[model samples]
Target: MKASRVASARSWLRTSNVPSDEYLEGIYYVQGRDFVDAGIVSSEIKKNLKEKGIPESIIRKVAVVTFEAEVNIISYAEQGTIQYYVEPGSITIEAKDIGIGIEDIELAQQEGYSTADDSIREMGFGAGMGLANIRKYSDEFEITSVPKEGTYLRSTIYVNGK
Candidate 1:
């Protein structure tokens, strides 16, 4: 099952949009309960931003947001995809997942509030700061979830700190 999930993720990555001169846009598929894969996707995004000459400070913010989002997907969702767009003045990241969605968005946004299982905690993650951190590092953020259905998170970081 794990192998098949990884294969599906790899296949999605391969078929995603190729970076263009005007802007960079791509989607990374993530499989739930896959602890290691989250970091891989986060690092790839960081590398891409660095290669594009994005300022270190902005890159750092994006990295944190991406990592937090990835961790959330891995820890809770059954499956998800992170889509990123680097445009003229901003970088936008959208994560959508099919999973046991949050029951309370308000409560979930609080720092130190987590629904992680023992396995997630054992992995040294799920300290309940993912959503809060993601919102903190983003210039704009929005999240919506349907219980037992899924969640959608969108975050944007402006290049000029807008």
Candidate 2:
């Protein structure tokens, strides 16, 4: 990502870094319903991982998971954030969103199940594959949500195949 772009993103995105053992970390805030900005977080992440010399295979997994999470946030939430940490053995990504949370996570996890509206489908998204794809690409995955509150998702991809 360019310095100017990162600076601009930080302005509206309210990004922050918290010191930790991880080699790299970034938090990108997502504005709900902003389809134009939907993939920024994932693009930045993929760039960062590439610069760090992370293997392409692993990077691909991270990209897929991050993009899916980002899309879901844009499609469903009032607002959300995607936080990523790169560790020696694995990369972890967490997406938390404030919205009408999933009522049935189990059902949502099933392929071809979606609550997306007509507009989302019109955009050629909301194929009901987001959650399923995220889980498929991660070595470890967990999700939790309260019906009227929000949703939180965490996924970890092992650097050295699990």
Per residue, candidate 2 scores C-alpha lDDT tens digits across 54-117 of: 8999999999999999999889988889999898899999999999899999999999999899
Q: Compute the lDDT for candidate 1.
A: 0.86
Lowest-sum lDDT 10-residue window in model 2: 13-22
Instruction: Write the residue-wise lDDT of candidate 1 on 19-81 in tens digits.
Output: 676788778888888875666677888888887788999989888988888889889999998
In model 2, where do residues sit more than 4 Å from their true spots? 1-10, 14-22
In order, the Cα lDDT scores of the candidates are: 0.86, 0.87
Runs in model 1 with CA error above 4 Å? Answer: 1-8, 15-19
Task: Provide the TM-score for each candidate, comma-separated.
Answer: 0.91, 0.88
How much is the lDDT of residue 140 in candidate 2? 99
* lDDT for model 2: 0.87
